[model samples]
Target: MEAFERARLNAYFARLAAQFTTPERPAAFLITHLLPERPAFVRAVATQTDLRAVLPKPKSIHAAARREVERVTQCDPLSRDLFENDETALDYIEARAADTPLVLLDVGGYFAPVLDALCDRFSGRILGVVEDTENGHKRYADCDKLPCPVVSVARSPLKDPEDFLVGQSVVFSTEALMRGRGDIMHGRPALVIGFGKLGSSIARLLHAKGVQVTVHDIDPVRRTQALAQGFTVARDREAALTGAGLVLCATGAVSLRGDDFPHLRNGAYIATVTSSEDELDLGGLPDVYTRTPDGDHVTRYQTTGHYFYLLNGGNAVNFLHGASVGPFIYLVQAEILAGVRMLARGDLGSGMHDVGADDRAFIAATWLNYFNR
Candidate 1:
């Protein structure tokens, strides 16, 4: 290993040990690296002590990973994106939104500019907007000022439904998977595995796109709800992988079994919207990996391999990229953006699926403008 790489690895493990000793295991984290190259062995190392290990060295992975991890763990960055070029960010966001009205499940605070712009341009035309938080009900109740309505189990839905639709209210969930982290919802072939708040929203959007959707969660009730929403429901994780162009693991569970992905066909993609990449053992797969802007360090186990392509190593797909527009703001952006997509596609009129490209671009642009402003 290079001198800097060795030093970085040492520092990373040391930090992990320190964190293990703390009363709280960081539920989520954003690791930034100053190293120029990604270490070949970018894998999750969780000891029996529960210390999560990551080499937040300088590289493409760390740079893009900052926003998602920081939001959930409440861990602040050592520095800020002081020199972030809005133009480039805008271009990137626009490009991603160009041809697709993606149903994004913004988890654990993964919202960025691209999402915001999509909403601003195509208000009321996006697909379903859903959010999951520790105190989803309370979060929605406390929302006095926001672009959308807050939806929560604790509150009465008889009130203005539109308020929550725009995220005037927010949902807070205290699930271990979230561990107080947040995420963003973008891209395509999105299949959020769990049918909790996050999974439902993703399913709703994808369904609108006329995309075949499937949802698998431990809860049979959620699976039933997904089925009602015109989504294919899989009772088993492995069953969910069948005919899925993309597999989005959002169960927030640790350690995904290899058998769950046995049928992952050639060119199939799997994005992780969870907490760690350690869940899936990609070494068993037969695909190559790729990296995203969010530092997910994706290893695509192509069909040539025995496994599947792992997006963000099954970590929070949002965290695999970059920047927090702040926690609540991030979720709000996600909700609105997805809502806008629904509106643009006329999905809401039928109370079903629809997503539009213009709306997608608008949300991305608006959020980008909001973040930099």
Candidate 2:
């Protein structure tokens, strides 16, 4: 939170706020993972339009953070329902749509079911959906039809900075954890699964750090991209996992499972960058895995002859162990805010669309100017 960074973020928020000029402000239901800048984003949205309900990702926000959100938004305490489960969340959204034309702002595809339900219940009343994560974009891609347009900020080229930050944080935190355990990352062979933005960055960072990095991706194009980038591309999952000291899952899709356990080298460290639990097969671990109070967030599983170390209980190791990617998340948050406004204007079509280049350029220019200043 340097002064320059703060000023730059304010500029981005201001630009996002400018996109909404309609006299009749639409009611918006936002479902997002609770992050440090969440309250500020919520306040920004409220200033432009009505914030009907906020359904934060379950277990993402703690009590103290929840209190801060309450104080900032002045939202009804009961309305802050965790949306504990998907069924409950969809029901709430359906109930709220009965009152007005609603806009949906999502971080991940947390509201996919709600959107499906609304297709029949409320139809064209949904202004649009602003989705902020790659996984969410993938979910939207699968839908045969959507009730309204979806502006996805996750795939924006403007997110390169944020992706770099995420990669740096993940590597930094992983190295710190290893160092604390008397292990060094240098010279160790590491396997990075998935060659998407986050994964590619992670692989490059790890390679730059002197770790022997191999990349594996199911997509031929992504694998070719990794090969072109000069990293060793694994022929298959087993080829990647065999003899690797560290394994990092970056594929948003579930790439590993219990059946793949036999391929892991003895005492290998496994971590995931994906937000969901399905990426790594935690269920495949023995029921008696040990958890120590040490801050590394390690869960140990001892099988027939091998031992496995799972980071952050197979959750996104970067966010859980690395302080949630620090302040760089604001860049993505800013894009999400802009996407919300763009969606509010109702100019996009019924399918998933990238955030316009003009919007991306504005954010990048604002950031660059601030950095140069």
Candidate 3:
């Protein structure tokens, strides 16, 4: 990353860290993707309160991120701080900080296990949590009772624009991946398995490429919106899967199960847009088909006489290339910082909370002023 770009990131993050502060802040445990832009945010958090640890997502770790993380951690990074597995993170935090008061910053629901295990012993020690992704938001929401406040920017309007850009990147990366294999997306039939903000963007962007787009959303409201938007709604999912040359899982849930595999077209390509690895039953693929390594990011699965390709080892294809949103991601990152300040205050009750309107406006205005300049 350029020094100028790094300065820009720190500049924006500095504004948020300055805007939100509490007299007494809680010690923080952060879980985020190890991307180029991460170090700036990490430094921004340090300016406010105690930063106990940083746990990078396994799938999103890149060489640039490693260098940045090393410098950010002063080159003496903790072995427990750079975990790739969710369980390892849960175990470390649960063991080390079960008695220490903590505020958690989570992405992709890696902290969900901690929330589930929040019994009496862990309750007083955990001040609050800030969640970043839809998958993580859902995981926290599903918790029977949260002992502390959990704020999420997952569905906030501040995150909507970023999601659209992310949708574009998903297509951009996938097409780039496929182009490497001598495949063209134009005029090909594609099926998108979700109609949320991200999924809707994917559908529209796919249509823009002249690909016949079919959407399958379990939610009736989402399906209605997709149909009204002039995309084909898959009333017969099997038939849709059978005809689709490409299938993208956008739902954070298990979109493709064991039984759903037999319906796919031979030589079809599969990918996920969501951060959740559970979007597809990856283990179930090898159960029913012969799994073969196909290239850098491609995996071939032979189903009897027919076979299909999976991209990025069933993870988000956007991660194949670094999942950087350039400066647009700062809008949401700002909200996360604001969330950190909120958690430090310890005012809100236990449950999932949305980003405050003030935080949203500050970021939107910050983004507009900087970009428009």
Candidate 4:
């Protein structure tokens, strides 16, 4: 009946003053927020105590999420500096532009300025070809069915790369967000599962840092890419789980509710950049720890459930919350281009990795210099 009443459902909030801060309160709110599209929990909480007055409108919740996303993008000190009017990001994209017969696929809340920035940066080198997919094209198409180049990758890739480039924004955003926060990501192994795009990016980053990375993906191309990137890719999920010091799932595929942790080693860290609504089978895993974003959803692991982890439990770390695709693109471009440049100069020796951290740091600092300029 009362909003704080729902908060009573959570043991973690036993000492709460108002009880609205409990996981139960937010969980109830999330349930009400979805499907029925109403804030039943908010209203209930409001009716019970002074908390009602503070309840944000349903539309405001969505607006808040958007605002949070935008604010994060603008203020990400590490990434913003790297991408603020980035020259290298532009240049790298331009080089790719010349390589016609490419496809660009954008998904999970991608925007046009990013696309336009890429296109404008590429300019003449950009073969008059770009394609958008999912929400990317629908949001950016013009009357002429063309994107503003600076604004959209508004169509699927045609047969020719010169005609369309399927942009991948989701993957870009995850990496960007993580880089912005900090280079180091720590979590339990079972908490991290699924070797999707986001998974591979994080793994590559860790691998570059000399951390052992174990990845599982059904796609052979993905496995090959991981292997090529100097990561240990696994065809069998069980095999991949071995020696997983830290794991994070980037897989988008949904599964039934419960725990599905592959036998985890002690103190292994795990996180997922996947959706949160669709539960993973986590019931059988070690009950040692559970964490979820904002604490609404949780994956048990670690010592204190109170420590609330961000990547597990149905919701994805990359798509649903946090990170910006624009910055991700900028960083990825910076890394790739630097690699290309080094190779062009005959500086890199045999079996050279894609882009080294020193180069990426230089790129970031270079962007920071420009940002200050």
TM-score versus the correct structure, for each prediction: 0.38, 0.87, 0.91, 0.36
lDDT of 4 by residue, 1-373 (tens): 2454334322111222132122111110001111111222223332222220121212113544334333322211112222235475465444433433222222322223344455455453221222222222333443233333211222211111211111123333433444454534444233234444335546645544455566666678777876787666665655555455455655544432333343445434345543333225555434545443333233335543223223434344433342233222323323322322332233332221334456556655553443233
What's the lDDT for all of these models?
A: 0.39, 0.71, 0.79, 0.35
Give the C-alpha miss distance for residue 14 in model 2, angstroms.
3.7
Model 2 clash number: 0
Which model scores highest in lDDT?
A: 3
- For 169-224, candidate 1 gives per-residue lDDT tens digits of 11111111122223322232444666655456656655554656767777778777
Q: lDDT per residue, candidate 2, 1-373, as tens digits?
A: 4576556666656666775444567888777656655666676776666777666665355555557667655433222233335466566666665666667787667666556666556633777888887877888878888867888888887677778888887888778777767788886799998889999999999998999999988899998999999999887678678769899888877878877767888778877776545477656455634444344677667756777777777777666642465545656766776776676776777888776677667766665655445
- Better model by lDDT: candidate 2 vs candidate 3: 3
> Which residue ranges in model 1 land beyond 4 Å of their true spot?
1-191, 235-237, 277-298, 302-307, 320-327, 330-373
Clashing pairs in 3: none
Off by over 4 Å in 4: 1-196, 255-259, 282-299, 302-314, 318-321, 327-373
Alpha-carbon runs more than 4 Å astray in model 2: 1-12, 58-65, 74-87, 94-97, 287-295, 321-328, 369-371
Winner on lDDT between 2 and 4 is: 2
RMSD of each: 21.0, 3.4, 3.0, 20.7
lDDT for residue 357 in candidate 3, whole number 0-100: 88
Q: Give the CA lDDT, 0 to 100, for residue 45 in model 4.
A: 30
Q: Would you list the clashing residue pairs of candidate 2?
A: none
Output the worst ten-in-a-row residue range by lDDT, candidate 3.
74-83
- On the 0 to 100 scale, the lDDT of residue 91 in model 2 is 64
Report how far off residue 42 is in candidate 4 (Å): 26
